[model samples]
Target: MAITNNRMICRTVFAATLLTAPFQIFTSAIGQVYPSLTLLFALMLFLFYDVSKVLKTSLTMKTWAALVLVQIISLLWAVDIREGIREIVYSFSFFLVFGASMQESKRNLRSLTLLIIAYSVLTLSQSTLVIYFRLIPDVKIQYLQGHLAEIFTSPNTLIDLFGSERNNVLDEAKSGGFEVNANTGAAWVGMVGMVTMGLAIGLRRKLLFFVSLFHLVAVFFSGSKAASLLVCCLLALMYLTVYISKKFTPSRFAILISFVVLLTVAGSIVVAAGSATDFGQASSDTLDTRKLIWAHAAVEFLKHPILGQGFGGWSETFQAYAWRQKISDGYPPHDTLIRLWSQSGLIAALVGAAFMIAFSVEVLTLVRSGSRTAAWIGAGIWCGFLFVSIQGLGENWGLLGTLRMSPFIAACFALSRALGYYTSPATRSSVLNTSVRQIKYV
Candidate 1:
C-alpha cells in the first residue's frame, strides 16, 4: 500500500512537470521559478522511488557529469563567478530533469505519451493565441505582452509583471508570444509541432496531424526565416522516415509524391511572400549580425583555447573586444556549440561531442531494432533531435546548457533513451518470462 501511494505521488508530480513544460516559454519570474521548483520536486520523488535506479550511471551520463564538473571547476577562473554559478545552476537543472524523466518512463510509457501529447496541445494553444493577437490590428505587441504577463502572474493581478518591460525586444513586429525573442518562440513551437507530427504518423492519430499543421502555420506567423527553413527540413526528414519504414505500394507512392509536391509548392509560396515583405530584409540583416557575433566569439575562443573563458566570461570579453574594435555591444554568441566552446572551453566541447555521438548511435540502434512501433517512434524523435541540432547552429537556446529550451531538449534525450530501453529485446524477454512464471504460479 505504501509503495502504491508513493508511485501515485510520483506519477502526479511528473505529469504536472510535463504539462507545465510549455509555460517555460514565459521569461518571467514565475516561468523561471516554477519550472525549477517542479523539476526539483519531480527529481526528488523519482530518487525517493529508487535511488539506485535513478542513479544508474551510463557512459552518456558520465560524460554529461564530466561536462558539468568542468563547468563548475571553470568558475574559479570565471570573470564573473556569480554569473557563472547561476549559469551552472541552470545547466545542471537539465541533468536533474533528464534523470527524473528516465525513472518516470521506466514505470509508465503510456502515461508519458499522454503527458507529452498534453504538452504539445498546450503549446499549440499558446501559439494559436499568439497568432490571433498578431492578426489583430488594434492589439500592440506591448499590449499582448502585458496580457500574457497578467495570465501568468499570481493572484491574477498584473502588478510587478516580471520581464514585462523589455529593454531589448527582438523583432517587435513578429509574433514572439510570451518569449523575448520571436525566433526562439518559433523554434520552440516548431520542435513541439515536429514531435507531434512524428507521433501522429507513428501512432496514426488524425488530431495530432491537424495540431502539427496548426503549429506549422503558427511558425509562419512568427516571421522567423531560420525557423521556417528548419521546419521545412524537419518535415522532409519525417517524410523520409515514412518512406524508409513502410513498404512502397502504388497508392502509398502516389501519396508520398503528392506530399512532396505540395510541400515544395507551399515552401515556394512562403519564400516568395517573405521576399516581397520587409521581413526578408530584416532576416538578411539578422543573419549578417549573427555572422559578425560568431566571428567575434571565435576570436574570443581562440584567446583562451584550452580552458576558454569561464561561463559568463564571454560578455566581458566580448565587450572589451567590441570596444577595441568599435563594434556594437550586448549581442549574444547565438550559436549553441560556439557559445559552449567560448564560455566553457575545449573540454566541454569534447564531452558535448562525445555525448551527441553516443546519443545518436543509441537512437540509430533503436530505430533499427526489432520492435516496429519503437523503430518508428525512435525515428520521429531522431528527426526532432536533428531539428534541434540544426536549429542550434543559428540559435543559442536549443542545446543542453541554455535556460530557454534546455528542459525540452533534455526531455528529448530522456524520451529517446526510455524508448530504447523499453523496446529492447532483453526487456521484452524478461517481461515474457515474468508473465509465464506468474501464470504457472496462478
Candidate 2:
C-alpha cells in the first residue's frame, strides 16, 4: 500500500501532540499531575481528528453488539451516567480512530519513532531542569512523580475516610532513590521501555538501543516489580508471537524469527544482568502485602459473583468485603478481573476481553499479511497494549475511578483500528484504493 500524503501529515501531528502537550499541561508547574495529561491528548485526537475513515467500519456487527451489551448492562449497573458514557465512548473511540489507520505511512512510522525518542530524551532534560532550579536534588530528581514515599504508596489514597489506624501509610523504607508514585512513574518508564524495544526491532537504529537502555535505567528507580516484570513479559511475548506466526506462509519467517529471538533474548539478558545493582530488592513484607491484597480481592469476586454494585462503587463494596475478612488495607483489588467483576459484572468483562482478544488476533493477521509499515505499527500497538493488559490484571489502572483510560491503552486501541482490524482487509483496500490485499497481522 502506498503511503499517502494525508496519512503522513495526520500521524506527524498526532505523534507530536502526544509527545509535547502532556508535558506542558500536566508536568509544567507542579511536581507531577494526577491522571497523566497524555489522556487529554488521546481524547483530543479521538474526538476531534478527521477519522471518518474508521467510523464506516466501526458500526460493524461485532462492535455494535459489544457496545449495545455494555450500554444496556451499564444502564443497569453503570450508576454514574456521565462516567459510564465516558467509559463506553473511550472503548468505542479507541476502535474507531485506530481502525482507520490501516494504511500505514512510512513517514508516520518514522515520525512515531522520532517522537518516542523525543519523549525518552525528555527524561534527561527534565532531570536537568529539576536540578538546575533546585526543585529537587540532583540524585533525587523524581523520574515521574515528586514525593519519594508516593512512589511506593498513594499519597492521596483517601484511606482516612475508612477510619483505619494506618491511613495512607507511606513506605518509609526510602533506602535509595526518589519517592515518586510507583504506579505512575514506574509504569510510564516500563511502557516507554517497551516502546523503545519495539522501535529498535522495527527500525534497527543504533539510537533506539541506547534509548531503550536509558529507559530501563529509569525503570530501575520506579521500584515497581510488576511494571518491570511486565516489560520483560511483553517483549518475550512479542518475540514468541513473531516466531510462531513467521513459521507459516511467509518463508522469510525463519530469518525474521531468528532475528527477533536473538534480539529479544539478548536484550532481556542484558537488562537483567545489571538488574542486580540497578533494581533495588523488595522486602518480603512488601511482596507479602501485595499477595494479601490480591488474595482478598479474589475472595470478593467469588462472593459477589455477578451484578456488581455499579461503577465507582468498588471502594464501598471492597471496603465492606474487606472489613468482613478483617484484612483492611482499604485497597480495592488491584486486579482487573476482580475489580471489573465487582463493578461491571461478568458481561462487561466478557465484552472488554473479547475486544482485546479479537484485537490481538486481528493485529497478528494484519502485520503478517500486509506491508512493513502497517505491520510494525500494528505489532507495536498490539504488543504494547498486551503488556499493559497483563499488568492491568494485577493493577487498578482501568478500575473506573482510579486513573481513567491510559493514553498508552488508548493508543494501542487506536493503532489496532488503524490496522483495520475491525473491518475486513478488503474494506480497507477499498478505502485506500489499492490492490494490496491484507492477509492478516501475522
Candidate 3:
C-alpha cells in the first residue's frame, strides 16, 4: 500500500508538471514559481521513492553531468556571477527532471500516454481560445480587454497578473491566453500537435486526428514562422511515413498523391497571402534582426574560440561588442549552438554535441525497435524535439539552461530512453506486452 501510494503521488506530480508546463511563458512571478515547485517536488518524490534508481548513472547522464560541470566551471570567468549561478540552477533542474521522467516512463507507459494526451488537450484548448479571440475585430478589443480586467480585478488594476505591462495585458486579452508570447505559445502548441498526431495515427482515433488538425491550424494564429514551417514539414514527413509503410493499390496511391498536391497548393496560397500582410513584414524584420545577432555572435565566438565567454556572459559580451561596432545593443545569441560556443566555449559545445548525438540515437532506437506502438510514439516525440530544436535556431532556449521549454525537451529525452528500455530484447517479455495491452485498452 505504501508503494502504491508513492506511485500515485509521483504520477500526480508528474501530471501536474506537464499540464502546467504550457504556462511557463507567463511573465508573472506565480507563473514561474508554481512550475518550478512542481518540478522540484517531482524530483524529491522520485528521490524519496527510489534513491538508487534516481541515482543510477548512464552514459547520457554522465554526458549531461559533464556538460553541467563545464557550465559551473565557466562561471569562474562569467561576467555576471549571479546570472551564471541562476543558469546553473536551471541546468540542474533540467537534469533532475530528465531522470525523473525516465523513471516515470518505465513505471507506467499507459499512464504516461494518458498524461501526454491530457497535456495536448489542455494546450489545444488554450490555443483555440487564443485564436478565437485574435479573430475578433480590433475595435472591440479594448472593450473585451476592459471587461476581462473587470472580471479579474478592479478596473484601476487592469493589468493581468500574467503580464507586467498594460500593453502585454491587452495583447493577452487579444491573442494570448495562458501564454504571454505568441511565438512561444505556438511552439508549445506545435509540440502538442506532433504528439497528438502520433497518438491519433498510432491509436487510430478519429477524434485525436481532428485535434491534431486543430493544433496545426491554431499555430498559424501565433505567427511564429518557425512553428508554422516546422509543423508543415512534420505533417509532410508523417504523410511520407504512412505512404512508405503501407502497400497501397494504384487508385489509393493516386488518391494520396492528389491529397499531397492539394495540401502543397493550399500551403502555398497561405504563404502567399501571409507574405502580403503586415505580419509578413514583421516576420521579415524579426529575421533580419536574428541575422544581425547571429553575425555579431559569430564575431564574439571568434574572439574567444577556445574558452569563449563564460556561462551567462553572452549578453555582456554582446553588449561590449555592439558598443565597439557602434551598433545598437541587440538581442543575445539567437542560435543555441552559437550561444553555447560563445558562452561556454568550444569544449562545452563538443560536450553538447556529444549529448545531442546520444540523445538522438536513443530516440531513433525506440523508433526502430520493431514495436509499432513504440515507433509511432517515438516518432511523435522526435518530431516534437525537432520542432524545439529548430526553434532554437532562431531562439535562445536550447535543450538546457532555461525553464521556458527545457522541461518538455527533458521529458522527450526521458520518454525516449524509457521506451527504448522497454522495447529492448531483455525487457520484451511479459512487461512490454502487458504495457501494450494497457495502452490498447486506454
Candidate 4:
C-alpha cells in the first residue's frame, strides 16, 4: 500500500534529510545539526522504506552492504579502534541514506542543493555557537607554544604562524598544536566551502552565494592555510568559467561581467579590511605553517615508498627523521596520503585513491553533460570535494584518510549516486525493470 503512493512520503523525507544535513557540516564540538538530525531521518527510512518494494538490486545504486562490510573489515585492523568503529557506524548509515534517497534511476538536483544548503546553515550556526561559548578546550597548549614555522627551515624561520612576532601569538594564547592543525578545523570548511561556490555558480541560485560566504568564514576561522587557499582557487575557477562563457546576451554579459568586477573589488576590500583584523594575522601564519608541514610530509613520503611501514607506524618512524633533521612538530607526518601510506601501507593508499579517482570521473562527467541538474551538482560538489582532497595531501582527513574517512567517502558515494554519477549497465537494466513493474501496476 505504501508502495502504491510511489512512496512519496518516504522519498520526500529522505530528500529533505540529505539536503538539510549537507548544509550544516562542522567540527565535532560545534553544535551543528547535521549528524544527529540526519541520523534520525535515516533511521525513519530504514524503518519504513521497504527495500523489497522501492529498491531493486541494481548496480546503479550504491552497494550498501558491500561498503559496510569493507568498513567493518578495515575497522578490525585499524590502529585507532574507537575512531574506526565510530566512523564505520556513521558511514554505514550515511551510505544507506545516500543510496536510498534518490528516485528510481534519476538524480534529484534541487534536493541535492537543499542538502548542501542545510549543511551551510548548520555549520555557520554551530561555528557561531563555538565562538559565543569560547569553548575551544584543548588541554595541550604547551606543545605548540613556540615553533611556528621552524619545521623545514632553521629554528629562526622568517614567517611564523603567530606572525613575525612569536610574542604576540603567545599573548593571544592560540598555541594548541592539534587545534591549529587545520585538518582538525580547516578540513570541514574546505569540504563545505569549495563545493558551495561551484554549486552557486552552476545553479545560478542566489541562496548559494550566502552559503558560499558562510563557508568562507568558517574556512577563515579554521586558520587552515590549505582550506583558505583552496577556497580562492575553487572560487576563481567558478568565476573564470562564467567569465569565459559567451552564452549570455550583451546586456546579461555586461551585468555578469560587472558583477564579477564588483565581486573582485568587494573581495579586495574584504581582504584589505581583514588585514587589520586578528584573523588576517592568524590566517597568514597558518599558511606559513602549512608550507613547513608540506616540506616535512614530502620528505617522509620519499623515505617510505611501495610497502612503507605498517599503520600507526608514521609517528614512530617520522620521529627518527625529525630528530635527525631537527624539525619541530607536535606530531608526526602531516599529509593524509603520506601518513596513510606510512601507516596502512601502499595497499591502503591505492584502495583509497581508487575511490577518489572513480568519484572524480563521475563528477567530471556530470559537469560536461550540461543537461542534468545532477550533472551540474556533481561539478559543484567536486569543486568542494577537491579542495578537501588538496588539503588532504597536507593533512590526515577522514575515515580512510583525512577529516573522518568513512563519512567523507560515504558522503562522496551517496552524493555521487544522487547525481547519477555512478550509474552502471546493470543498474540501468534494473531501473528499466522497475519501470516495467510500475507500468504493470498502473
Q: Which number leads on lDDT?
A: 3
lDDT of 2 by residue, 1-442 (tens): 1134464455654564446522423333233323334444445554334454544554332643464456557556565655565556545544433432333322133333344456656644332322232223333423223443343233443223223523221332121222133454445555555655655665555676676666555554444555555566566655655455433354554554455456545654555564555342242334466687777656666765667656665666556656775666357567666655656677766665665565555556655644454455456555665555656665665522122224334444444454444234566546442322222211
Candidate 1 contains a number of clashing pairs equal to: 0
Per-residue lDDT over 126-171 for candidate 1, one digit per residue giving the tens place of the 0 to 100 score: 5885586567624634554455554332222123223432322234
Instruction: Give lDDT per model, in order.
Output: 0.62, 0.48, 0.64, 0.48
> Per TM-score, what order, best first?
1, 3, 2, 4
Show the lowest summed lDDT stretch of 10 residues, model 2.
Answer: 167-176
Tens digits of per-residue lDDT, candidate 4, 272-362, equal 5676686566555544666666666566667666555544555555566557555553444556556545544565566556655655555
Model 4 clashing-pair count: 26
Worst 10 residues of 1 by lDDT: 433-442
Q: Between prediction 2 and prediction 4, which has the larger TM-score? A: 2
RMSD of each: 6.8, 8.4, 6.8, 11.4
lDDT of 3 by residue, 143-261 (tens): 44555434322232344332333322245233543444455567767777887887778777788878888987888876566677778877775555444433424465356446545
The residue-level lDDT of candidate 1 at 391 comes to: 64
Instruction: List candidate 2 stretches off by more than 4 Å.
Output: 1-17, 20-47, 50-180, 248-303, 321-329, 370-380, 399-405, 409-442
